[model samples]
Target: MADFDKPSSTEEEYFAREDIEKKRKLALQQADQLAAKQREDLRQLHFMKCPKCGMDLHTLKKGHVELDTCFNCKGVWLDAGELEQVLAQGSENNGKVMGAILNLFKRS
Candidate 1:
């Protein structure tokens, strides 16, 4: 006569597999949370910092655009569409505004 109170081998295997799957899901969720936290930390560390010299950036307002200028590196950074706005405003006076701005640098 076999004992009916004991669990079968197949039932034990199913529970083991279920435990492993639950552990895997938990680890994946933890990894995703850690990755998100790392990204936010990096963003905070590099926010508004200059790419060239790793210095602070100042906002200079010109017309309708706010430019990010690094005084230490003397680098000016423009956000999306600001350059086009500037060029469009300048083009109202003459259509060759881009060419005129390009001509400011002497040919070497």
Candidate 2:
């Protein structure tokens, strides 16, 4: 049989080793969680296919929102309150016009 513990293994020494091991494990777990969150955020930012033209959809920044637009069909796709955020920015000369255009491409 092989002995794993050191020859001078005191109770305090064992507890100190356990504390270091626990801290290492917690750090690894927190790093993994952070990596997973970053991957999910990157996935959410990926471009999608245009429902109107089947072409690549591009993201356009409207205020704080990222709106998906199809350059091929000149169509825009809004997720939830993205349109409201865009309009609320008080953009001049093209915001209202773009909103009208987006409305024209709405499905049902």
Residue lDDT tens for model 2, 67-107: 78887888778899876776775466457756755675676
Give stretches of model 1 more than 4 Å off: 93-108
Clash totals in order: 0, 0
Best by lDDT: 1
Cα displacement (Å) at residue 51, model 1:
0.5
lDDT of each: 0.79, 0.76
Residue 11, model 2: lDDT of: 72
Cα lDDT over the full model 1: 0.79
